[model samples]
Target: MIRIVILLVTLVIGSVANINAQSKYEQGMGKAFALWTENKPFEASNVFERIAEVESEEWLPHYYIAMINALNSFGVTDKEKLTLQLEKAKKHIEEAELISPNNPEIIIIKATINTAWIAYDGATYGMTLSMKNAELYKKAFELAPDNPRVVLSKAEWDMGSARYFGQSIEPYCKDIERSLELFATFKAESTMHPSWGKDRAKEVLKQCKG
Candidate 1:
């Protein structure tokens, strides 16, 4: 009887501990995202780094860290700064892939990091990474064709290329519209899972119409 009581008590304590850990993780992510929304990306990345230290097994934190670096690397004027940022992003991308291999989102972010470098100096990186960039998006789409971000990202890339060559972007605009439709009904695996790219898609669609 005493052993049974002890076991029940232990279970309750463990459950409570798990709840507390989840609560902390949720709170930390909330703060980090708030910081990001406020345009405090470096600070947000710092928060994610702290959360990642505790949630070492989770891939989302690493994904966010890589994403922060990857997005920030865009439109950067200094080549040296861009290189350092992308290198850090690649490190986190590797970490995330280790936890969640072949993740479509991770793969897309990897492509975005390359796009950042390409955007920064197409003359320098375009010839080298451009093919790799197309391959990444292709692989990501093959993995999750219905994924709104994947569709949207690929379409955006195609549109950019078309515009570069003075070709029509209207064809890829349909993909953007399809991505929006998918976003309307899209469901994330969890609250922590990514549910992004809809707004960006909407903006792009508006551009397509305009």
Candidate 2:
């Protein structure tokens, strides 16, 4: 009887610990997502890292860290630095992918990496870079069909890339058009708590449309 009583106590303690951990996970994700939407990715990354510590099995934190690294992949000319950044980003992304191979966010991170590569390559080969950018954006869209943020992010990148087009008005105009379209689409679907993509999308649209 004493052994059975001990077993019951252990089970009760385990259940309570699991509940507490789950609550922390949920709260962490909520805060992380809020930070992400507000363009506070550095803060979000920290929160996500904390979440990973508490729940190592969760994939979102690792994925977000990879994304933050990928987004910061500009002006890094040193091959060694670029390689290290990519490897660091890949390490977290691969860890997440192993946990959830079909995750839409993981696919988006892959697309972001592709974008970073193009950003690193810059204007040396305009057409090739544009083609690669378009391919990555399209793939992200296909993988996350309902994810308006993917479309919006593509639009932002297009506008950002246009500044380097030098005397070419075509690319700039195309980017503006794409940004407007994406923002409009996101606005139409704002009911789902479109997270950080909505306001950012609208801000970009206003810039381009004006």
Which has the greatest TM-score?
Answer: 1
Q: Global lDDT of each model? A: 0.79, 0.59
Best-matching candidate per lDDT: 1
Model 1 — TM-score against the truth? 0.86
RMSD of each: 12.8, 14.2
- How would you encode candidate 1's per-residue C-alpha lDDT over 61-169 as one tens digit per residue? 8888888788777667898998888998999889999989999989988987888888788898897787898899999999999999899989988998898899999
Relative to the true structure, candidate 2 reaches a TM of 0.56
Worst ten-residue run, lDDT, model 1? Answer: 12-21
Clashing pairs in 1: none
Query: Which residue pairs collide, candidate 2?
Result: none
